[model samples]
Target: MLKIDDLIIDKEFEELLPVLTPEEFVRLEQSILKDGMLDPIKVWEEPGTGRNIIIDGHNRYRILKKNNISLNYWENYKFMYADELPTRDDVKRWMLEQQLGRRNLSEAEKYEMVQKFKSVFEQKAKKNQSLGGKGSTNLPKVDTRKEMAKATGVSEGTYRKMDVVMKSDNEDLKQKLREKKVSVDAAYKEVKSTDQKPITVKQQIDRLDKRINDIDKTIESLQVEKEEIIQRRTSIFYALDIKCPVKYRWDKKGYSNTFPCFWKCQIYIENEEYENIFGEYSVYYNEFPSDCDMEKIPETYRNDFRMIWKKAHDEIKALQDEVDKKSMENAKKQDEILKNAMKLIPTDEDKVILKQFYRVLANTYHPDNKKTGNAEMMKHLNDLKAVWGI
Candidate 1:
């Protein structure tokens, strides 16, 4: 009798983009149905809880359960003894690294993996600060894309644009990218174009040539709005609420018997129970008083936590700034295209036709522009072109 509580899947790991496509999943399910669990599921037993946690073979386990299939737990699965447990971070990081290092992931998948890995990295950094000194951060001031891309076996630029794609928040476009309907460069451009501000209907109904001329001014307004939005969106993460006077026990086992001690915290991220995602972090707190009650938490540790917490908040601000800056720059190109195309639009019925609007919009977004050329913009541009038969 297999109980549901016997194993819990790591959502932090499983929520990553699916490695298996629909066809691949079908094939895997078929193979498992016929072979009857040839591979053993690897699980870990939690200390003191006497509960088994699944570390791998999640897909196989799921398929079997869904089919109401049963097998001998001891005979069909592998378990780790309590003393040999890997931390939640360890299991997730190792599994992701293994997949990235072993598999030939698509550029899209690689980017998604990096984004997921980064959050895990950030969580680990936060944990480190909580355990050790107060003013420390794990990530150095370097090009993250370059380092992570090297790890993923891709170019830095490739990963950078892929990061842009993840930020785009359009799954249909992402699917198109996967299907080769869109290129990376075009996807980035599409993101920017979509950020274009909506104009008032009166201005939209104004003289065509005048409206084109007003785009530059409209773009400037959008730039200001974007800056305001970024400034207003500096976000903060929840800090660990301390249960005062945290107690601890120590040991003295040296030749001269010097006592070495460290610090630890039981924190829930975002004021929510985060145990399913991870466990509390522990680190060497060299500055701890031998007989200390962590009432105030040491200054060094506080400063470290502050640095990590503030960095996460600041990074969100910085990201918004970067996005707005890019949008402002791209808006300039799009407006200029409309400005030029307006000069060519004849003052006839076609001038105000909706299809003509699509046609002009398509030309501006086309990937082969001399001044605004972006091969990556082709898929989106083609969609606009199709509307007007251009």
Candidate 2:
């Protein structure tokens, strides 16, 4: 039996209809338990995943599952199939059309269904164009959103407000729209007013705090990147029997017990060293930007004395450049190694042995052998074969 959570739903389809409330679902489940499902659930298996994707009767199927009702073909559910529907896209499009053609929908349902149809069609059209072909829908490219809104019975002005409500990141606001608790005009007004409202002192402080944290994160990312580049360089140096020395020198002028002292980093490629292979970043020894001074500057010189920021900026830039240069140099060294490796021409005897090995590995990793095979391993093997020109 497929888990409820595992059912693959089209986003367009989900957005077309409102999800049942908890109480509504329980009532539906009770009815299904007493009456059984009168409607057949339409579904098809996903192409690659082999998972069941529902095309229609989602609410009924959900209720049946909740009541522990098994869906048997010809008894409870039916496969929505046609000879011409060769792809998932075609099936999905057909399902949407079927939904839109329904006569029993409410005014709300009709509007929502039409919206889903337009959105899905527009997406397919753009996708087709990106693939160097035109959409089969025969819809034009000009003012598509406007055309869709007009077709779906929403005026341009009303559609604009509704669109804002639809796209708002607030879940409660979105829920209210779905439940029809707030009219589009009301939702739009609420959202607009909230958005236009001036930020309070706390919110401004929070925003500044978030910005500081974001910058701190960026510094950490750069620090990590620099560490990786150094590690890669060290690995290549080890392979070539060369060792490089690195030195650190700190500025004493800006030193304070409460604040941080800025430092300069340099590499010594020719010198000898028995230690220092800083590969991955470690919290113990590493003094990153996050580790630096967090003490607030005195209000006396906050605006005029901005040298601290400049110093930090210059240090970060110089260090980042050094890391990038080393990375490029190391990458060239790696390419040279790969070129030398590629020069090893396999003899006929070697090819015969390699062919046998490949055949056995390919069989083991084939997708059909679900028990023993892994898709990732198969792809990796294929990639290596291509790289080696085998």
Candidate 3:
């Protein structure tokens, strides 16, 4: 492990975008100034790039920069080559090792450290590749169509067409494939055939235009199906709460006796002793609808509620999973957008928009706020900002 004070910030480090929040930067600077950096950041040497790849401590790195603290305080523990950095599998293995030492470090802290290590390695690899000399040359090409075919044991050609079908910006084709209403391969082939051009711009544009129109129609139809699914799911998960008075009143009779109807009720969970001598227990009740005949209620109705609860729980769970999946995806997407936006050499107007978007997302998706809401969904909020302009 290299000491933080011995580290040298390479000129190439200037290329790194500041993604860490100013608060994070300040906190890190404070930590460094107080207890001092506990861990040494790793860097691998890229001979071609003429720079070192950082394997850990990107957050601290940014904080240092924000405080105008130079990197001269730290030392680099360099690997001879960029390929020497750990793979995702290697990181996972190291994480497992940390778990084995779980007696010492809390699980959350260990996971955080592992993630920090992975980020550092990734950023370093990226920097080295971009800066100069060849780094990690034998990295596998990751064209999804080819990889998916390999993984699913499908023919490459078949998968290639499937990829096109999946990505076809055409709404109609997307809908058909999503609904499994049309053979994916067939649609792929048809779209490909239609788009085959005579190598002229005019011809290409015409083919694309036709394809897009077809896609738009498909998307429109698919959207209807999507809406139906949403409605069904909503109904399945619906719960109502009612507390009200009757519109029709009798002058002789009291209000409660006039129109006795069960309304939707609120649910509350309570723990109470079943008997004076018994231990505490939990119960569910419909608070608002005051008069549900618990004895007469059929098992079917009970089961329906149960099913709805399960369905809502399951759907929310599924949505949560998708949120996580999409967050990583969006992170990668935002990274690309940042790279592209950098290419535009953004003017002041773009910069202002980008900063505003970033600030809003940072506030919305801050880790503290995520604890109360859906963390996965909250994570995506930041990614959305990045895509918009950050």
Highest TM-score model number: 1
Off by over 4 Å in 1: 1-5, 10-13, 17-26, 72-75, 80-85, 101-103, 127-151, 169-172, 180-182, 193-390
Each model's C-alpha lDDT?
Answer: 0.56, 0.58, 0.46
- What's the CA RMSD for each of the models? 30.1, 34.5, 39.7
What digit string (tens of lDDT, one per residue) describes model 3 on residues 109-166?
2323332233334444445555544555556434443433443335777556665765
Off by over 4 Å in 2: 1-17, 45-52, 62-68, 82-85, 94-119, 127-139, 142-144, 147-152, 168-194, 200-390
TM-score of each: 0.42, 0.38, 0.21
Q: Rank by lDDT, highest first.
A: 2, 1, 3
Instruction: Give the clashing residue pairs of candidate 1, or none.
Output: 134-300, 134-301, 134-303, 134-304, 135-303, 135-304, 185-376, 186-376, 186-377, 262-285
Candidate 1 to truth, TM: 0.42
For model 3, what is the alpha-carbon lDDT of residue 275? 10
lDDT of 3: 0.46
Lowest summed lDDT across 10 adjacent residues in model 1 is found at: 255-264
Better of 1 and 2 by TM-score: 1
lDDT of 1 by residue, 1-390 (tens): 556446777543465435577788788799988887777777766443355767667787788778877756765577766455445446556657766776676677666666655645555555665655655555343454565776556687877777677555467888887666888889878866865866567645554655565465445544643543433331121133542222222222331222122223232222243211112333233222222333333442444443443443344345446666777889999999999988765554643575566666657766667776566676766665554344
* Regions of candidate 3 where Cα sits further than 4 Å from its true position: 1-18, 53-55, 65-390
Residue-level lDDT tens digits of model 2 in 1-390: 444455566543454455679898887777777887766777766443355667777888767666666666666666654454545447646766676566554334445655545544565556656655444456445455675566556787877777676654445876776677777788788888887877689777776876686576556544643654565554455454443333333443454422232333321223354433322121112333232232332233233223333444465556556766777999999999999887786666776777777778889998999778988989988876665456
